[model samples]
Target: MDEVVNAIADPVRREILALLRERPRTVSDIASRFTISRPAISRHLRVLRESGLVHDELVGRQRLYTLDTAPLTGLAEWITFLRSPAGWQHRLDALETEVRRTSRERSTTPDSTAPKENTA
Candidate 1:
């Protein structure tokens, strides 16, 4: 569970994992998607690989990277544990996540029926 949490903590690493979901990609290919240099991307990938969320294979001169879902098994178990009636923390966290997402979506679009506040 610690590995899963750490692996997902960084937005860049998460994006890298998302890219690996579609298919294997070379290090350079993954680096091209972001503004960071290849070495920075390598560090992120290293964390992911150490966390068991990704695997790499040497294909000629380039390394091919792919997603490894095995670590997710532990995450699923953790989620199940967190969803139990005794786990109020998880419930609150889930609610907070939903609220944030809803607020973000609402902020992007105008609600025609809503009243405008005038502080004059």
Candidate 2:
């Protein structure tokens, strides 16, 4: 998950991922989208490669980068866990609703055990 987050943290890297998600692109092709130098794009590719977010293959003289997409499994798992019924936010909301319901019930129902106080 850390790798996935780190890979996506950079806007350039995210753009690269978005591009490669559609189709594999050459380093030069990827570099062309940015105003940064080719070397700078190479550095981003290195980070993406290390993060397992991308993979490269040499096709003849050109290196083609493709999205690996395996590292995203951890991210998806985390999102799924957060969206599940066991998540804290959902539990807190439910607890709050129950408390409000109980409060409303108490407000509406007069206490039978206590003596009624006279209103001025």
Q: In model 1, where is the ten-residue run with the lowest total lDDT?
A: 81-90
lDDT of each: 0.92, 0.94
Q: Write the per-residue lDDT of candidate 1 for residues 6-118, one digit (tens) a residue.
A: 88999999899999999999999999999999999999999999998999999999999999989999888889877775767779989999999999999999997899999
lDDT digits (tens) for residues 1-120 of candidate 2: 787898899999999999998999999999999999999999999999999999999999999999998899989999998778776778898999999999999999988989888998
TM accuracy, model 2: 0.70
Superposed Cα deviation of residue 6, candidate 2 (Å): 0.7
Residue pairs of candidate 2 with colliding backbone atoms: none
**Prediction 1 global C-alpha lDDT:** 0.92
Model 2 worst lDDT window (10 residues): 81-90
Best by TM-score: 2
